[model samples]
Target: MARGTLFSSIAGGGLLIGIVSWLAGTAPAAGVQQQSPGSNPPPLDYSLTADSQPQPGVPTGSLTKHVLAPGKFFPGTPHNYQVYVPAGYDRNRAIPYMIFLDGSGYAGNNVRVPVVLDNLIAKRDVPPMIAIFVDPGVMPALSDEAQNRYERIFEYDSLTPRFANFLIDELVPEVGKSYNLSKDANDHAVAGISTGGVGAFVAAWNRPDQFRRVITWVGSFGNFRGADRLPGLIRRTEPRPIRVFMQTGRQDLVNYAGSWYLENPRMAAALEFAGNDVRIELGEDGHSNRHGASMLPETLRWLWRDYPQPIAVREPQAGAGRGIFAELVPHRELLPPPSNPAREGGAGRGGQPATPPPAAGRGGGPRGAVYALIYRDKPWEQIGGVYKSVASPAVDKDGNVFFADLAENTIYKSDAARSVAVFRENTRGA
Candidate 1:
């Protein structure tokens, strides 16, 4: 089989869309539960696409399962993980690989990762690679009176380098013991959904040197365990060589923390503001993985659209993003001088005229509204002395303007009197 066209890579060759016939109609799956959905969303009768199903002509891969005893990372806990080696994979040559959190979650049911990999590899749509399906660790109960300890939240929800150390220091090296794994960070990817979805980002966020690509489906980047602070973190930190593809539904989780629906978009905006390559898809379904699973085949295509070439951090463009991005606008003329080399031939042989920065108030929209507000009437004035990172300034009905110091996850309010004060602290990226 030959590789697909460039468009096919981005569009997944239109590989999705045949996953179901709606077996249950408007009724939801039995015992389905969520905080936002009063009645569980409808259950889906999914039929696999040719790519997601076993094909008579496609080459199949082998999946081997192993038990992992908890090590220094999380002592006394143990779990299981699986490894996949595509048919005809060479023992001497190293190959790319991916990490899938909530391992068994994606391996079967609607995803059927083994089958999907077989088809994608056979068609040469994605590079031949290995996949690690990782199940969360749990502390076994010692007696009938003792309750078992679940580590999923502490492992996946906390936004720290601990989980990253677990993967990069312990789990990955253990997997490498038996197989020839690629050492290039660009060749590695991490993925997860819901709580595990944020886990995937945390892996790469803390260690861009080990993984450069991130895939999340309805990622729970909310206040569950300080994950909502991710967007602000991205806005202030230097950009990492990472590419991200996230899927969020209109009807996602919402609780005492905040709305995942709002957080995901805000997260995307943060990545954009930080000059990172990011893509997002918004659907109409609930928080369930129905939509994310249906688009799995296509999501992979977009994640690795251009192969071999490394994913790199992009330079922030003036007026290109929301929140802190407005600070990048230029105060001088938008066009280069007529005698400048850029205007002559250095920029291009055709000498195309440079596009001016987005119009001040009209161009940046809400992003620049704060900039306009700051420089309006006269010149920009320093309101406060200390601010690590500022993002999302909005005016209330009473003419009170509020903005966030993303690094601290604190929101500040500037009242009509022009005095700025702390409105809320520990917003968790709200």
Candidate 2:
């Protein structure tokens, strides 16, 4: 039941380009960080000049509309998408390409991505690239008065590989049928705003072999169904060959999901800890496209700055801490054996089983008993059992002990009287 403009394709020559410019002299917003020198050049004025716009003699590209059938990825859901081929596109050459989510909004005049692409492609600031703007799917309502079931939240916010699979398996193949898209991951990029922004990152994260560059603006990296765990995943997983650009605003949404303002920085820190190539830009604006649209031209340039340069993976620094590296890495040290064998349950100097020393204030307790007294003031006793590889032991207030035998995937318990019994059955190899 979702309604919008119908599908249509327009040749580059038929699409009119007009000159529009925004002054870049305005001071940086309150929370905006100034770019460092030699870094991405300051955001240039995206206003189209006569040369930047399509002139009488200037070569222009084409915009084509496409519809993806329902049930192709999401059952009973359909989506509309647009593709923009730059002015210099050559059918024979394998060119760089990018996929943008929230297609209708971005493809419109508000974002004017095609116009930005046109200007940048003309100025040689960015390599000639194809842009695919894809809208999220919608499930139609059965009645006219009923509302349609929008799938944007489910499609964009879920932390699954299905969306990525849809792109890599269905959409990319569909696009490839019409154009010579590059097979090299270096030439592929994915981008989106807000929920779509998170989707963009997820797609590349799940399928780095298909896409290697990511741009996320005001991304919903908060707890929108497990997305907040991405930072931890990034830190724990081995580094992948992907470059990332992230942007967020101080005034972004802070609701039941979580604060976008905080999550973006956390993600950046995790990416940095993992030694991935990542750049983040922050501003005072809210969770809107004002900042993202204004900076899109520069973002595209930075994303593809060194064309064909293979994105490099860095070795995670030692002691990065709080990741798989920290948990699994071994720190070796040399130490002499215990000076007294008796303390380690070994034979004493006289070649007899050594009796452990008693507590300072307690007497008449069993030797080597971990506890000196039971709750009833009875002597502490050891359970009558010989166990193999006992692990993760716990004791109850009633003087009962519970432990697991990981090798057998079984749990055992001991009563106060030193009797042992199986507490549980197979534990699925845990």
Clashes (backbone N, CA, C under 3 Å), per candidate, total 1, 3
Residue 413's lDDT in candidate 2: 89
lDDT per residue as tens, model 1, 82-127: 9999999998999999999878667755467778888888888889
**What is candidate 2's lDDT per residue for 1-430, written digit by digit as tens?**
0001001112322111110011111212221122211234334343323332344544567888889887567988878889999986789999889998877666665566787787777778778889898888878997999999978778888789899988888888888999999999998999987778889999999999998999998888987678899988997787778888887755566566666766776776677666677776656555556677777777777788877788987654433332211111123111212224332211101222232222222111211122333233465656656667688888764457789988888889887566899998798555
Runs of candidate 1 exceeding 4 Å displacement: 1-35, 39-48, 321-430
TM-score of 1: 0.69
- Residue pairs clashing in model 1 are 19-47
Residue ranges of candidate 2 with Cα displaced over 4 Å: 1-58, 318-430
Best candidate per TM-score, number? 1
lDDT of 1 at 73: 86
